[model samples]
Target: MMNMAQARPIAPNSPSQKQKLPAPRRGLHLSPHMVDVAVQVAVVAALAGIWEFGARFGALNPFLLPPLSVVLGRIWEDLIAGTVPVDLGLTLYRALLGFAIGAVIGIPAGILMARSNVVRWFLDPLVSIGFPMPKIAFLPIFILWFDIYDTSKIIMVAFSCFFPIVAATYAGCSSLDKWPIWSARSFGAGERELLWEVYLPMAMPQILTGLQVALPVGMITTIVTEMLMGGRGVGGAMIMAGRFADSVGVFAGIVQIIILGFVVVKSVEMIRRRILIWHPESRR
Candidate 1:
């Protein structure tokens, strides 16, 4: 028979029992991502403050670097006047359409080049020569062949975007581990099955990287074409402002461009994260 003290259970709320349990997490705990975002926002806010104060205090020339408030006011005015929507729409349409065309053609061509010696032999020289050349120089030829409207601009953007996608895709597919291919072949996988199931999934990261590079190039080409063509886009608005010596309007257009680029780049990054959810990088 055990002694009464030895057999008895402790009280539920005893101090010793409380000490054995884990302490509740205390204070506000910020995630690394939240901290990073806060830092970025703070830096941008600081820069904007400097811009506003510097212009107001005469440290910066108002003509050259307008006050942040003035620029925001100008943008608001344009937004209310309804010109911004039309310009933004046209620019986005041309850039996105051109990028789509480039990707559709470039991805297949790259896969073929990687798979077939004949295709590689034919395209390698063209890619090598064309990649180094300033694609913008071909604008004159494009202009002569097509009109100076959206057609030429879209084609020019597509032309600029093609090389990066092809190079990235080819490299990704060619450098894949041979062991997987061998195993797939051993299991009686057809060429189409191997490509779809193995090659594309493995190479998707590189393909997405290529697309990220190409989108900026496409946007730049679109803007330059719009500027040269003098049409209804942010670039065209900037050029018009320059001709009329409306510095405020020019600055407003620049702000629009910056916002547009930021939105687009962030959107693409989000898409890449979604598409690459199974990738190691996405886990990080």
Candidate 2:
């Protein structure tokens, strides 16, 4: 009973049917992020290749700049001998301990300074003078007082880190929007509640930025302290290598420091992203 057009069963592979279905995707498609990562990797690889080949081909002096393989071999030897782990552990411990001490003391002082005029007046001069002055200048004094030990080293690092953290915290807390405070007050939020719920949460980004700045400074200070104190750390190892004119050992130490710094910095950035998930910058 159907008409001729309907009577003929439509082909399953007809043009109309084919048009309704999605076209088959061909080959690999890379996202922008993947492309960016590829570019970065390529750049690093190129630089490393240049370094390796230049030294191997005598374009670079073997004594001043040994081939990358030689440096890596030295590092491998240290790793196999178990000395690298101990030295790395000691350096990280001192740096992290000092950073913790600074953060613990600095955050509260910053908040207090922002909240109270009296505290600001009292601490302002000290922070101003201390922040600008080379913090390492006080190392000798610390050495005299605390001796050439972990105590002096840690204190020196903490001192270097404190100023940046406190400054960042104070700036963050003081430059807050008044509307949020007024709203919280109208809702009967107590001082403690306001501080915990409003102030810290709002100021966290700046505080984290300060921490990022302080961490590198702390590491630098730790290295200097280690070198001066002559202890079992990467800095000490580097100094010893220099004394013995061991360029390979010195370069190996440098590589270790670079790796340590890169790892810590990336870790901090990840932490910041996790903590500030709601922040606008985190979306980027």
Best by lDDT: 2
lDDT for model 1 comes to 0.93
Tens digits of per-residue lDDT for model 2, 1-284: 77898788768999887888987889999998799989988998898899899999999998999998999999999999999999999999999999999999999999999999999999989999999999999999999999788999999999999999999999999999999999999999999999999999999999999999999999999999888889899999999999999999999999999999999998999999999999999878
For each candidate, the alpha-carbon lDDT, in order, equals: 0.93, 0.95
Backbone atom clashes (below 3 Å) for every candidate? 0, 0
lDDT of 1 by residue, 148-245 (tens): 88999999999999999998899899999999999999999999999999999999999999999999999999888888889899889999999998
TM-score of each: 0.93, 0.92
- Candidate 2 — which pairs collide? none
Q: Best by TM-score, which number?
A: 1
